[model samples]
Target: MLWEALGAARDLGRVHDIAAVLIRYGFGDLVQRLGMARALERAGKVLHLRGQDDIARLEPAARVRRALEELGPTFVKLGQILATRADLFPPDWIAEFGKLQDAAPAVPFEAIRAQLAEDLGDLPENIFAELDTTPLAAASLAQVHRARLADGTPVALKVRRPGIRPVIEADLRLLARLAEIVEAEAPDLRRYRPREVVRQFAHSLRRELDFSAEGRNAERIAASFADQPEIVVPRIHWQWSGERLNVQDFIEGVPGRAVAALPEGFDRRLLARRGARAVLKMVLEDGFFHADPHQGNVFYLPDNRLAFIDFGMVGRLPEARRYEVAELLHGLVDRDGGLVTQVLLGWSDAAEADSESLRADIDRFVDEYHGVPLKQLDFGAMLGDVVGILREHGLALPPDLALMIKAFITLEGLGRQLDPDFDIAGEAAPYLREVILAHHAPDAIAKRGWRGLVSVADLLAGLPHDLARLLRIARRGSLKLEVDVPPLKAFGDQLDRAASRLTMGIVTAALIVGSSIALTVNRSDSVSLIGLLGFVGAMLGGLWVLVSVWRGGR
Candidate 1:
């Protein structure tokens, strides 16, 4: 574990900082429970705990969001990831997490130019014709600047912030340890799956830090839409791209957020429809999509085309998962509660839940949306309601699915922003139908049947050997069976502790009895002194036993 003594020593300063933030946010109890307080004290670190009561007056969710913000980029990104977990948190918590923004003050141009020069193997002037010192945008990990190539092609240069890797790495290390502590010590927070969340976030953040990976993601998405002239991804200038630097064609169009600034002839409704269809195709048809499609990541070009940028975050759905999603969406539209319930249960990787209760809830939800016009229906709200039900039933969507849902919600919101009457349900209908039809086609069934047959045949071929091995193990008396029953194991641990305490009590009593007899038979001062020492030792041992019992009682 990263929180082991050796590893924690290396990160003692970071631990102190994190604990200080938590305490300042009125989470000192959490800090103590996680053993951070004890560890910090052992390292001789003083924690400032003043002003906590004032911060405690704020709502818990708000306090957590503020703490994350203060903790810097890694935690802000974590909060953003948490914002997508509708099935793990209630609406209030999710809303608070959504408030986290990635904006940060830009690193100075002089420092950036030094890194850029090293990355480019020469000065910035030697590569690009002109590079602007002013940053176009600055974010938590990187900043973008406008530049022009030698041939006069305009481009945007995305440069990783100098010395960011070490800071983020330290934060990630502390986060890993913190997640472990929360999982082991805070049973109430265990349902949130802190370890799994941190693991996913770490993987995602690392991939995002690699500018080359973002370039590759952009190319892949661009290739996916090569035949469609309406959707555009910036052409990657890989000659200058690397782990720390990305160069791509600059998009010179109306920013997606500036709806009022669109050229006089641009059609908002058409743009909305096209954007929705493009995202649906990526998700349902291509099985890969942009995880974040917010206004900042999109631009509007002439002829009503859309330009999507920033491939830092994306989602991929396997073939099986794509089909399941299609089924779920089809069921929702058709008001088939049973189908929806089945798809949901299949997605839940937890222990069996109350299927009948879940089915009833799904039916009620479906009925609530029944007869609603497609144009008037709120698809995002519907998805949120479904996720709320899953939350109530103690089920959470897998990480990929959670990202997909968040993307869908963002897409719908963007659509409505462009056109007041935009209908995501109507726009998604055709793509969903195609996916469902493709899954049930005759060729698809035959392909699945052939795969299943191969699996069964392999199993049959290996059956005799497996049985022979099992028989041999049994004959040698080496067979083993293991059962994991948490309650019984817990009771056994308690028994072990109680037995140890009882043994200590018996030893203490024996010392007291022997010492009392020695005191009565003492003929010299030394014997009496020895007897007195024995009595003192007995008293200390008795106190230990009493304290152990008292603590165990709680």
Candidate 2:
């Protein structure tokens, strides 16, 4: 580990040099914040000093943006993620990070040729009828060169830069270690879990490095969107693709953002709607999304179809959670804060349940903001408030959920940029309504009921054995059995509590029915006493069951 750390440190020095270029280009603030403040200060001692005012005059956000650009692709990608995490970082940092693009200095043709040969086991000439020596586009991870197969099929050859993986791996290891150290030393840092963040970054970067993975992702996304002709995903050329290199059918279209510069034929409004709808469907309906939907990854094809590129990062939600998400969104749309709180609490772990506090917070949040429409609500602000409440109550969301939230916000922001009037809430209404209807459909209710009945039957079937064991233990000189008696006892306690709850429900229903009957019958006010007593009894019984169940859990 020490040797690895030292090697990583050396790699870190190289990264620092790259970062220094960014810092020199007016991104000193971002460079410093990327865990290089001390190094930057040291460099400053050797390279003359600039006062704080001078640094501020350079514009902190622009400085950070330049630094990310200087640092190369991996850091640029990191900056994109940082841009979305408005809750974690300041607004200025988020704004600055958003400007950081993944454009990188292109490797020389010789280096690209060497990498292609190493990956494909041949020179470009042998594998292709023609290969463009000039790159179509150069990015941090890989550069694309337009080429054609021997069969005369036009393709794009994406060749990874020579020896890029080692640099990325080394930097990731250093970052992971740094995270561990920070988590150990700073309690606040522990909340973010530096190691986990690095791990996620490593996973994302690793996928990007392996062109085969990107190809697979593209294929899967293509399959998901097959029914939607307006959306296009470039077909991967599996025959010539390898882990380090990717070959795909070359997409001939301008970027979606660049459509503004194109001829008047393109329908910008329709294009924007198509892009937003495609992304929304991926996130809400399909539950599998192309994580990066920036302008560069989106293209406007002929016939006004929207094409998506780059599948390095994707998000998926489990089917159950996806259903819950549908419900949560529906609740949001309906302005039912209680339902939203319930769904959120259900998604949380048992350890996080502080019923009193959670209920109070939900009540407050609902009272404060329930009537506001989705268009009027700032999703980020709402999320921040909820996160703040959860933090105060010592609750934390699972990492995947947090990532999903980040993805959702990113999608929203991207959609807004494309179409300022794009109403995500309105667009999602039909989809969410379908989900809710499915959830509450008669068939669904019957299915749930049948499942519940089966569970009850299973418990009843076990009751005989349980009772026999109890009797046998009572008959024996020593009470002994292989059963996990504690859980069984808890279950019995729960059953008793349930019985108490049922009795309360019955009594409450009777009271309501009797009161209505009395009102209709023109009975005197004194005649309502029986209903009141029944109501009180029901309340006491319900409270008793709650206390019993709570104690049993303890």
Candidate 3:
């Protein structure tokens, strides 16, 4: 079905590959339902539907992870994106998704040299004083190499893998179509919001594909921290940067993953606190933050300073969302269950849920930490429990908030890795307080009031035209009113059933009377045979009436 609807011959090959991978992962039934198997078979792509017992024995989450790994870079990126959707998936699923590393075998320098030369506007040897042929790191989308400018400024050359755009774009097209098909055909999977998730992923991935966007992100974050010396964002060199290439000052420091390599003088506790504070400020105060703060994206410099790199994926919160987050944190800290419930309900997009049950759960969650000190509270655990409550009620957070929550959790985990006694809530307390105070400040209140007044003025200004249009439509007898009253509809259904039973009973009675008269007045063989048939039909109708009456208890 989707193959015909998609109508792209170029995607058929990708579909075959996806179907083969899914079938190998014991998801053949899904492929069948999605019509991939039939479509591919029709297109002459043979798929092996058996011999996956080894992989099929693993747990569902692990199997999915393995399948994603086998499916290539685009699916791995999808799995990585799914890791941030804790509100939509359980812990097991999220854990499996989190395990999806972007690591890939390095594409040899020679393969990418032509593209690099084009983006750099010169040969690498001509522009850089020293350029390493071997990549420092390789990922699904790009690889990094150490280089130095002609002026001896050490920088990192982030180069997009040659011919990656077409591959990724093709995958995105298939994913969008699959999401549509899933939403339309799979009722049970609708809660996952496949279409919405795909839309968000496409936007993020497209932005990530453009190295210039990542450069812009780095500059913005560096500007935000220009005054702070502790938080280091690499300086983006734009002269040689473009959609396919990013050149930035490379910080030489202890990689975050190499915790054992920390120098003896490094202050782990202070580092943890500083990290927490920086991220909290980014999310709460700045309304923009790096979405992926995993170990590989971070480095610890001497003097306990932190360097954050790789701004390919970032999150943004609008002013309203930031305020809502503050309110949520405020409610949790103050043990205000009502406020917490209100904010959570505002964030969820579920059409229907048990509100009273959700509120009760929130109240219980709040009471669990009623008197807990700020320093003793675990912000990560608290957020996890909140996500659990949302999941229980079949609610999912908006994509932006989901990314923010994932960042928060990752930050807390990184903090704990560095310092066993790290307290995220303690680090977040001051920022939350500032946000709450700002919300109530006189100027802020007056500004909101002024906006409200302006909105009302605009509505009042447009009321007369609306009334005139309505009056004109009414004069033309074109006005229509539609009402949906549940009780009335139910009553109407009952009346319809009663009328149908009454008509059936009347027809049965007429048949019985007519058959009896024919049997009594006509003794001829033909007439008698017709009367007997009528009698049998009347008996069958009577039985039907009796069954209906019994079933309906009428």
Candidate 4:
């Protein structure tokens, strides 16, 4: 009945379209292995599925990227998320997925005029001094236009596409169903955790679709860095923001990617250091960070202040995880391979492997770089190497933890692009040091100890009740213990058969001895019944033992 329900769901949702798309990209085997081939057959018969003619000509990574792009926004977002998972995917695959584009044609302004006016509480003319119909940027989810307030304050107005939510919501449903099917049907994919990845993607998409959520994120991050004059986060105007639309202060600065086009006299070195410091602080201290800090999402103001945009995807860590990560980085600094190994394993419940071997691998990674001075070490290259090792060892990080790795990698890349002598390690060292000190501080230790003692006391308080319940069950003769013993069952049976044979041999020996003694003593008593009976018993026992051995061997 459960399978039937799943089958019906497969037919009802977009699984058919999804399967057809996979088949077109030469991923028909994946579809079959996921137990969706029957649905694919039905879809194929209806749609007359045709594989891409030149699919075989492309590399596997390129094929995957192309398939995702053709599948639409949800899959593209999945690809984008996968691109951040450097510790799971190969470098080539990550590179290919990084190219997943969400660009879409702009929606007509007339179509969204009502939504915009509604979100803003009035028409554009009534609420703003001026508004531009032409979009400053367009994407599958939303588009932004340049606007100005009645008080002459410049702002960026983001408008959601007229009917995109339903489409995205439908795709999300199909993806959730498909993820469940994939996890259940394919054991090899279990380690990759397709279900968990999809869950994270769904959560992220929910946050992304609501412009107000993004506004809130911007506000929180802005507050985190409020004291730092070197960094800028756009001010969100909540009065005009809603689930579908957002309004924020317009930033007038050069995009970080176009460093060559910047006017002369700009201090690239200063910009690079400030950028690295800002991001490092966010990860190691603030515990909240913009996960995507690629060159495009950054802007450079005239005073060398760096601005971050796009709060759609963010990463957060609690204090505990933050401390662990900081210690991991510090381990890298001190060349403490064991500490690094411990921290990495603590980050996720990865498959068990040889801890010594993993530690050795970390030692090798650190030894190759830690000896070099901080400023001279290639931090980006070292990080890439670590990611490769992690993938090889099946130590893929959880989604939120992986985001910090990606963020740091992005910051290093940006730094290197702006200044060849950029020092990521140097910039991150002080923050990590502070975290490490706090981690071992006396007050922190005492607090942790108190928490542990409270947990132990709670357990003690419940011990008597648990013991009474167990004793009551045993007394009532209703105690049942469930155990896994398939491996032991055969061994137990063999031991039982051996013990029976040994007992039979002992009985036979005793009978023989008694029979001999009786025969000797009754030699003159002609035809003694006791001796005859003893001999018969011995013979019978011997035969039984022989038969048992033969049967057991067979």
Candidate 5:
């Protein structure tokens, strides 16, 4: 791992300008804090340094922009995620991170050609009537070019940059190792386990590298929206695709935001509503959603349909979990503390939690915030608080759940950007209500009952064999029993021991009382032998009780 980090550091030397800018902005401090100072120092000399006061003098957003542009794509991507994670970074950092673009210097034409030929057989001319030499855009991982098939069908060809795969793999391994170290050393960061985050990152990056996966994702989404004419997904040229190269029908449309910025006659409001509806349908009805719904990934088709471009990041919610999510959202909207708590606990796998204490915490959260409207509530803040509480109580959300939350937030933000009046809750209400009702409706109930009856019948059909086995066991005068002894047995044993001691304590008190009474009644009598015996017995019993109690406590 150290060798890999050293290699990465050496690679950074090639981008000296970026390194210089990073140090000049105050991002160096973050690197130092993360224990990468040695790498930075080895990469290149710090040509400039920005002190805290200097950072204060500049706009936070400007400083961050400089730092991201200087740090390159990996950190830029990390910053973008941090921007969404209001629970992790400050608002200013989030804002700045959001502005970090994925733009990078284009690879040489020869390099592009070599990768294309390696991925897709011969040169562009062999497969296409014509291929543009100039790339339309260059990004961190790949660049896209305009091309046309022999049949004159226009398409966009995305080719991976030369030698990027190894770099990405190496960096990911380093990041995963670092995450393990952070998890081991820092309790607070354990909330967002670095290893898990790296795993997610690796999954995403791997999918991004394989054009086939993105193609399939696009196909699935396209099929889901086939009934909706307002949404369009581009066709993938599967015959020309490979792990490192993707060819798809080129979409010719203005970017979503650019379309929104048009004159009043454009009906931006309608566009926003349609887009929100499409995304919500994908999430609620289909249970699959595009994780990245930013404006860049969206385009406005000439026919007023929404064109979705990238499918690199997508999320799938299992049917059962989707139902749970629906219930959770409904509970939130209804401000039902008991229901929310029940759903949360059902979702959790914590076995050591004190149910009573958890219930109290839930009650407090709901009582404090349930009355607030969804629009008025700060979901980011609420989620942060909930996560903190869950962590304190030894509960953690599964990675998929966290990713789903991030996707929802991204989609919600995109919708709001398109239309300020957009309300995800309002848009989701009709669909969720129907789902909830169908789940509990009489017809559904009848279906469930019929299913249950069928299962019971099957069990009954097998009952004869079970009965024969039982009879055989009875005849043999032996039966095997399997039981999981209650885990509380240890506590119960301690309680039993305490009870025995208590009984001894009562006997001791009784003896002492008898001795006192005898002494008082027979004062000045001959020997008072019974009183002496009672007193001795009482003292011995009391001492025994005390010793037992002490031992039990230890």
Candidate 6:
């Protein structure tokens, strides 16, 4: 019991920290809804952590954004990830979460020395000609420092903070547990499937934790763009980089955010087109893309090129998704509402809904884009409305597809920021056409058909053994089905007690009658064994009845 209490207190302590931040940011109602308030009660009563509920004054979505920010890095990463799921959240929530940043206090250089030495294989001075003791940028997962190679090649060294993994792992476990409880206790919250969301978040976060994988992503993307001089991928220093750190060629150029700061000869229109083209090739041609290419992750070279940084989080367009995306785009561009509805139904995880209604809603949506030239159409707005409709209908896109759409929106939004008339659809059309047509080629179709045939053949070959095993289990009387019946044991116990009482009462009454008969038949005898045994059995039966009654009462 003491150990149980200690465990409760520990959970409560962790939960109180989360609850206090949430309540302070105006999410107290949410906390109450999730039943976290009960857990926080003891903590809250001891100290008044509940201030004014921020939700009362600010918009709920805005308060949620602030709450996630104040909750720290994991939540911040969650909010950013949630920002990508336009199919699940409302527009205001997405906008607010998009504002979530990984900005964290810098780990002093001296504090990170051990990690640097371990990853770099020696002291920083020995490994580099010069290493800036100060960080160029500091984020939650890692910090970047400017450094120079022995041959004077400028590079950026990203060092992971010591002991960050355990903190993140603990938070993930807490989140998983909370998600389970919320799903179990709150029926209304089940639709959001908090458990599944946490699962997805865990997968993404784990990938982000590995710097070595991120380095490989960089190399793959760079190789994809090797022939395109206009596109730049900073070369990764594989020998010196590891899970603890990432070293890459340091890029010197104007930040993508500073569009107005481009030199006199720089062309904004050309830059926007080139940037869009580069991203399209990464998506449609290469099936890989920089998922979060906001202006902050981009750089504008003096030679009018676009340099992409930060490959930590990227999206892969599988051949299937790529094909479907092209169809989706084509459907929207041509006002083919039937095709649009088909694509949406394919991605829906919920029970099949009214197809006709879906078609009507999509037809109405597609009609809005009619007569607008493809070049003039706002893909971002169109996508937002489509996703909003999906959210309304309880449909969810796969994570990769959602991330792909968000990337497109970000790219288009960035392009328009640079030049109001820039059209991402126009820039992406040729590339999309090439890929879609290639997939439909006779050879591609034949290859896909043959793969399907092989899979079906394998399944058929395995069916016999599977059936034989099931038959063997059934014949041996070993086939058992376990079910989840919460009150089955209590019901069975009641039935057992009643049966035992009935049987005991019957036996007692029979023994009393039989003993009377034996006594009647053995009259005048010195001793009667039958009468004596009958009397003894009666007494035993009576005792059994009394004991059962007492046990039952107790």
List TM-scores for all candidates, in order: 0.90, 0.66, 0.84, 0.82, 0.66, 0.82
How would you encode candidate 4's per-residue C-alpha lDDT over 429-535 as one tens digit per residue?
Answer: 89998988988999999999999999999999999999999999999999998885543765787899899999999999998998888888767655467778888
Give me candidate 5's TM-score against the actual structure: 0.66
> Runs in model 5 with CA error above 4 Å?
1-69, 263-266, 338-397, 437-554
Pick by TM-score: 1 or 4, better one: 1
Preferred candidate (lDDT higher): 1 or 5: 1
- At residue 380, give the lDDT of candidate 3: 84
lDDT of each: 0.89, 0.70, 0.88, 0.83, 0.72, 0.83
lDDT of 3 by residue, 134-251 (tens): 9999999999999999899999999999989888888898889889788766666787788999999999999999999999999998899989899999998988999999999988
* Lowest lDDT block of 10, candidate 1: 1-10
Candidate 3 local Cα displacement, residue 266, angstroms: 1.6
Can you list the residue pairs that collide in candidate 4? none
Candidate 3: residue pairs that collide: none
In lDDT terms, which candidate is top? Answer: 1
Residue 477 displacement (Å), model 1: 2.5
> TM-score of the candidate numbered 1?
0.90
On residues 1-554, what C-alpha lDDT tens digit does candidate 6 reach at each position? Answer: 11222254545565667778876776665676555665554455433436574356888788788878777788889999899999889888888988888889999999999889988888999989999998988998889999999999999998888888876776787788777767665666566678888988898788888988889999999998889898999999999988888999999999977877788877888888988988888887888999889888999997788899999898888888888888888788888999999988887655656778888999999998779997799999999899888888877777778888998898888888778999888887787788779999999999999999999999999999999999999999999999855357547878998899899889889988887887887775643677778789989988988988875564
lDDT of 2 by residue, 120-153 (tens): 7777789999988888888888888889889988
Off by over 4 Å in 3: 466-554
- Lowest lDDT sum, 10 consecutive residues, model 3, at 545-554
User: Residue 360 of candidate 2: its Cα lDDT?
Assistant: 75
Residue-wise lDDT of candidate 1 within 232-273, one digit each (tens)? 999999889999999999999999789777878899999999
Better of 1 and 4 by lDDT: 1
Question: Cα deviation of 551 in candidate 4 (Å)?
Answer: 44
